[model samples]
Target: MTSLTDLSKLDDILALDLPAPDAGAIEAARARQNDLTKPPGSLGRLEDLAAFMAGWQGTDRPTIDRAQALVFAGNHGVCAQGVNPFPQAVTALMVANFEAGGAAINQLARTAGADMTVVPLDLDQPTADFTTGPAMTGAECLDAFLKGAQAVDSTANIVILGEMGIGNSTVSAALAHAICGGTAEDWVGRGTGSDEDGRARKADVVARGVEQHGHLSPLEILAALGGREQAAICGAVVAARLARIPVLLDGYICTAAVAPLHGANPAFLDHCLIGHQSAEPGHARLCGAMEKQPILHLGMALGEGTGAALALGVLRGALACHNDMATFAEAGIG
Candidate 1:
């Protein structure tokens, strides 16, 4: 429950120069990988991914000991229009589940050696249903975004963003449609296992919202259709990059939040690592729009930072291999 005023605002962070992935660190990692005991290219993409991490961290040695996973939760008024299969109560309940460390993400973070935070952003007052009007005011959207920025742990080199809201997927698609310039029908998908009929109904909701406000700027698009959690995640992405932390992105709703940031600054993608591809229909298109490939394709749509937490282990292994593998000369093998 960090306040928006507690952290540096997204406006301030975006005003500063963002660091790109370091070329020197990347080359150094590649050289060391070639010198490792394994035959050149034997470890496959691990060598490449590890090198990317080095470049991201601006060092030949990249570590994620203080990885931070924040689950931003809130209610969407759009849920009242039958867009969600679940009740709005689930949003508040899940925040409690996160706080108790009883949710799947809690267990996953414990195993990943990452700290977890459940951020309840503006759940006290739900956004207006965008089918009729804007979800929130521009000021509110900026506040939610700043609160998201505040949630990040400065000590964390790896940041994971996820969200929980019943009808958020509908708003996510709406936001994406506005920012990415796609039809609402193309971006909307079933959330919480909505049936075919429910999907169409949800799609119509987004279409109506987008028809009214699709051409607005990033913050305007967010104010028009974005949910509280989505706004926060968007701000978090900007803040993480300001601190030069590599991001581990979750699925559809999360990426939908990401669309505006990508639209505003394509360089933001260079700092993101897609944790997994979601079963949500529009997610692949979202990733495709960013020209990013996910590390896992397990067809997961359960968003609570579950995918990112799972991916942390793989990152840790990559770091281990990069630092511990014996060189060919050291082992007298070449």
Candidate 2:
């Protein structure tokens, strides 16, 4: 919360009580909205989500003008399991693209006026192929969380979480099944354009992981089933909530990463906004588990925080409308 330096243990970080949204600010925002010239509730969920942002900041005027995207990049060893179409090195290549401002997320974030930062993690060699063995050691998973938590910068009040790693969806489905309660078939999906045969194989891989290692503690489950970037995204969610920043959850892999943390602390969901529902099957399950509705769908499955980055523009518009709409008294209409 405090610049993420001098961090405590991972459990200690998650155990800390996050700052609560200000009820008084929320009430005030709602009151002002009633006086606006537009019909009550006409603006609908856009109005609602904006109010949540106001309460999240405990302010009469909430703005996401300075939103930032936290994109975690890493490689998964299970990529060798034939889960993805691209080679795993594309993870590093995409990171370079992000750095070079060449990826879709870069253009989307720029278009939405949000800054982007990439956090890199190394677990490719250490993490076992969960289809055959554990994805990571418990200590490594804890360390990944610590690093992810530490990735938060002081510049932005709203953070959008995204990830890059070949075969991450396989890990995501595995973690979703292990944590959210579902069959591997229910959780697996076509990532990066996998064919029917590929989807079936992915389901089998996830099922094998769950069968061999299931019902561990949330952290252990993460280490056993999730990738390094996924672990970091989980920690980043906790840190964002502690800092009272509205976290924008990206597609399947990103949302899957947050499930464990939300499982540990229900209050953490207060600060999260499902950026959008990813096209991936497991994304819907994650949203169902969280009781969240995706603000925008658009059939997006690209997972560089692209959906979340684009949604920042919508949030900006929502806040602008909330703050700038004329009241009946001001407009002399009532």
Model 2 lowest lDDT segment of ten? 1-10
lDDT of 1 at 215: 71
> Per-residue lDDT for 1-334 in model 2, tens only?
4534445444555546678899988888888777888999988987887779889888878876577788998778777788889988788888888899899998898898888888878734536788777888877887888788888764577998899888888988988888888789999888988999999999999898898888677767888888889989988887787778888888888888877776676677778888888989779878988888888898999999999987887888888888999999899996
lDDT of 1 by residue, 3-35 (tens): 334444334434546778899999999999999
Per-model TM-score versus the true fold: 0.94, 0.95
Runs in model 2 deviating more than 4 A are 1-10, 123-126
* Model 1, CA-based lDDT: 0.83
Clash total of candidate 2: 0
